[model samples]
Target: MHVVATAGHVDHGKSTLVRALTGMEPDRWDEEHRRGLTIDLGFAWTELPSAGTLAFVDVPGHHRFVPNMLAGVGPVPAVLFVVAADEGWMPQSAEHLDAAHALGVWHGLLAITRSDLADPAPAAAEALAEINETTLGDVAAIPVSAPTGSGLDDLVTALDDLAGRLPQPDVDAPVRLWVDRSFTIRGSGTVVTGTLPAGRLRVGDELEIPSLGRTAGVRALQCLGRPVTEAGAVARVAVNLRGVPADALHRGDAVLTPQRFRTSDVLDARLDRTGDDPLPQHLMLHIGSAAVTARVRPLGSDTVRLTLSGALPLRVGDRGLLREPGRHRVLGGTTVLDVAPPALTRRGAAAERARILSTLDGEPDEHSELRRRGIVRKDELKRMGVPVTSRPVAAGWVVDEKLWAELRSRLPDVVARWRQANPLETGPPVDVVRQQLDLPERSLVHALVSPPLAIRAGRVVRDDTAQVDHLPAPVAKAVDELRARLAAEPLVAPDATQLAELGLGRRELAAADRAGVLVRIGDGVVLLPESIDEAVRTLRTLSGPFTVSDARQAWGTTRRVAIPLLQYLDRHEITERLPDDRRQLR
Candidate 1:
């Protein structure tokens, strides 16, 4: 189905054209129809042989009502930018175009209405030239008169042709249904109407009211006024929710997939100065269906930091635009940097700029999305325009390549620091590394690190490189003393306490063992590999081969030392243990 919205200056025949094509009144409010002006969002649907079926959002064209228009146009991909032939392009018409472009609406057809009242050819040509300079310059424009139905068929054909060319909508991502209009039903609960960007919504589906922080169930679903069990992307649908209040929602609110989207107030964007003038530091920000005052801070050259009024969870790369209400000028466009921006006062300009630039320009395609949005859900990243890779172990996701590189470089540095500070320890502990890098523990081991380092079974190691640095003073002393002490009396190996006295504790000893500085011959008994070699030689020379008792007496030790020493020799394949507990070379 094709979803399109009507946008233009006030009283430009957008509503009249909608009524003529769909035979339904787009003006929902009694005051609007009585006044013959569209103050709120109006919904109508038409069926065309070429386009099949199309839903229309007649957005308010007045400057004061542009916010309402944006809410209606937010999720739709195509639009009917209506302009009266007599008026040509007015101030509000230009603002609507800017809003459409900022919201990322690319495909559209221009409808020059009221052609009977005035010649539309020249005006339509001028409007077309203005639009083409922007993203929608190549769109088809049809001149029509709603009062006389003049050129309506030609307009329908143009719309049908545009609809046919639209890329197929992805319904498999997270559900983001922006509420353009909401009301309460007597028997059912609150009902919301808007375009579905992606994901499927079915009866009994739980949707979270982001502005309300509450979850509601889908009691019933309708598409184009027909009852249905489910609705997919690119469809205009009305959802009856189970337990939400009509008062709790507004035009800017959204019903989204739960446990996935989050809210933030900080946005990073690229501002396009409308008339060759940079946007002032303070201006109003209009996005989706809501408008709020925002303070802008330009970074480097193209990026800007936006401090918003309320918490808005916007994920990285959410495309939006900025405008000043009093000025009615396009400040610039922006993608989300940090939805919840850090405290600006506490952060210096350079830091703030870096944070904003990082979100806007850095890592456009590497790490999975980092921002949590209120309207979009977990699965939406893959469903939207983002490119994600899917696997059996993990679902497909969006990532910023530059972020991955930064992480890869920094992660190993953190691990190296941890390992250097702890010589007696096995590589850096997983939890420690996770906290240092601010990365999830599940992917910690698998996370890429520069020099290709990794933690293997709690032992940190450079993938192909062995541990190389000399032991620290304390650990080094312990290693030297233990080796000297073992050589002086190979029969009696010192326990953990003995090592502790020589500047090593159990933890340090364990670390040394992992580092291969010392080997444990038995419980609480350590043997330097060098000492073990000497003991094995002595036993092998004595009587050619010896029993456990003979080796014990020859080494001047008890069965404890003799037994482990013989076992250690056997393990190294230096000797074989016989049935009578004797040791001999194979």
Candidate 2:
């Protein structure tokens, strides 16, 4: 199915052309028929020869109804731009074209209506020339008289070609159906209609109404008035909802795939046109049938910050239009850059933010996004439409490459400073390091640990350097003598009795281990830092599969010291423990 929006001047025969083509009335309201002016959006559909179904979202063309026109055209991808042959180019014609052009609607066919009243050749030529200059590119203009049926067949053929050429929609994409009309049905519950640009909608599908923090089930689905179990993209759909009331669902409300979108009030966008005059303090932003009042701040020559009155479920690269609410004039189009923008609080922040926005081309690349947000949740990047192909630095969290490097570098200094300032203590607690680095969460600090940095007894340590260098004079003297003794006797670990005699209690021993002064095998057996490596070297000379007693003899240590040391090596994967109580190098 294909959907197209009608854009042209009022009384330009847009509705007349639609009526003739579809054999259905395009105007729904009694006021529209009585006044002969389209006051709101009207819908009509017809089955074409080769095109399955072609739906027309008929829009009002008067200056007062420009917002209604924009709302109708916002979600549709293709258009049937109309112009009156008798009047040629009109004011509403230009304004409607601007709205469609700003919305990135490039696929279209021009319809020169009211051909019976005057010569159609001039209007067809002129309107085609005007539309070709916009994002609508080039379109075939058909001069048709609805009353006389002149050129009506040719218009249908042109429309069939346009339908065949419409861009394919991604059915696999998450559903975000923007409601254009919502009302209660007598027999059925609430019914909401919108253009399903992409993604599939199925009966019984539970979709989200983000603003209400609620979910609504798809009770029924209809396309072109035919009930169906499911519908795909590029089709106009009316959904019967089960949970939400008709009064609760309004125009501009969206039904979305749950958890697929992030609702944001602040946005950074790329403007299609940055005119000589700056944008106003406030403007109405229209996208997907939504007209929101937004506060604007120019971030750069082409970028602006928009703070919406309420949050909307938005993604990067989504296109919208900004309009002066009172004038109903479209200022320009907008391409969303960042849905989750940082707060601009400091001096010169907006200037710096503009520089960042300029570097982005609106495509959500992983490197560019991760590089911008140093530390972020994996889901946040996904919700913002960023593809995270690379592995995360930590579980459920992604860190920028440069930021990770900075964290690794700064952590050593932070731990060293903490140790130096408090000699009796181990390194700072994990929570302290998290706050000191201003990390988003506590676990991120653990992912930042690298070489020369280690954790001993659940506290951070500088493994390569013995930071016990800052120990008290008396303790330092005692530890130096013990180090010399262990240096000579590589694996004869100090017993608890000997440690107590040297005034080294559990706290002092724990501090020494965190400082890399010695390796504390459990059960009060302490060895020099390099004793494990020395034992591994000696064991390598023995048989491939060696006994516990063999390991004890190789290290020249007692059974107690050797058992715990071997277990530590096994835990670190330095050695493998055999089923037969034997050991071998891993």
Winning candidate number (TM-score) = 2
Which segments of model 1 are wrong by more than 4 Å? 259-262, 336-364, 367-586
Best lDDT goes to which candidate? 2
**What TM-score would each prediction reach against the true structure?**
0.69, 0.81
Candidate 2 off by > 4 Å? 463-473, 476-586
| lDDT against the true structure, each candidate | 0.73, 0.87
Query: What would the per-residue lDDT of candidate 1 be over residues 1-586, giving only the tens digit for each residue?
Result: 7888988859738888999999998887888878878898888999877768988988898887766776777778888899899889888888888887776678888989889989999889988988897767688889999899899999988888888888898788677777777889888878888888678899999988778878889999999999999888889899998878657777767788875565666666665555567558788776666667788877656667788886554555676677766766666566664443444465475565565464445233323343322112225543233344532121222234454466667876777787678765657766777577675443533545434565565655666554323356667666777777777776687766676678776666676677676777777677776777677677767875578888888778778777887787788787887777666887
Q: Which ten residues in a row have the lowest lDDT in candidate 1?
A: 390-399
Question: How many clashes show up per model?
Answer: 22, 0
- The positional error of residue 134 in candidate 1, measured at the CA in angstroms, is 2.1
Candidate 1 residue-wise lDDT at 240 = 93
Q: Per-residue error at 556 for model 1, in Å?
A: 20
